[model samples]
Target: MINDEDERFNSELDEWRKLPVFKQALVILHLVEHIIEGIHLDDPHPSTHYKLRLYERYTRQMMENALLIPSEIATADSTDLYDHKMENATIIRKAAKEIIADSKGLQASGYKEAEYLELLYDAVEEFRPLFAEWVQSFSTKNFIIDRWGLFNPPGVSYDDPVDTMSFDSKSFLRDLEDDWDDGDDDDLI
Candidate 1:
């Protein structure tokens, strides 16, 4: 049996996939808004805090394809999708580079913590459109969305211990708050 947290995450992902494009976009935006607001209220150094750190971070960009239906037109195929995604990937790459470069500059100028926060927020915002486009171009090929490669990047963990169908009030906010780890281990990375 799946753990409670895992079930909740998977269940939520399934439901998220089931939502219509317009609705999905709204949901993503809403989640982003809350997360952004929470940045000021929550632990800024937490790994989960940066989940929306980029368009490529969690393959959230790939979710863009959730509403996409493959074209019935004869000319549409992988080549078309690839060409389109490549262009988008280019844009995503550019924005990512800009965010990184600017971040380094901000640090070099000795505005590390304070300015970095604002930069992080803007960088995340830059990713929104490219991510949405990715979702927009998404089409299932052999039953898989095009975002297959981009979903899981380095450092963003999706694994958890909750269930989707049944609410685990037991560990609900606990996991989100990550209250258990005491930082005694130095094996980070």
Candidate 2:
């Protein structure tokens, strides 16, 4: 038996889930920004650890989604699909950089905010290059169909099927192995 507020919140979450991946990433970025702002404002109840955890979770999600964009672009069936994926990729990258810059600014102030900003800076530094690599991997591709034909070309089937690229969760987890060493396990919550 859920209350009205809980039901409404769940309904909203369902709608939110339906949004495009980049939009979802933007929402997470905004959430991270808001949480940092709250910390700056000296909100007493949530504590630094709680806020840092939330920031980390949102940043991680954004990074993971951004990192997968190149594979998505590479596998797109049409130019329109590739263009859409590229647009989303650009948005996610810019948003990520913005968040990183914001965290850096906070860190530079030499105040209490620097402590939490350091956590964010560390997380962003660890994940930011992966997103950049994904973007770079796609930039050299010839997406214009009019200028050039498909990599497979029409009526040219190959003996070996090309494998579709996907997000590798194992590799992602391995990259973050150090962060998980603390065994805090609050991420399960």
In terms of lDDT, the best-performing candidate is 2
Cα lDDT tens digits, model 1, 74-107, are 1122233433444444444454444445444434
**TM-score of each predicted structure versus truth:** 0.24, 0.34
| Candidate 2 local Cα displacement, residue 30, angstroms | 10
lDDT of 1: 0.39
- Clash count for candidate 2 is 0
Model 1: what TM-score?
0.24
Candidate 2 residues lying further than 4 Å off, grouped into runs, are: 1-80, 108-111, 133-189
Q: Residue 162 lDDT in model 1?
A: 28
Q: Which candidate is the best by TM-score?
A: 2
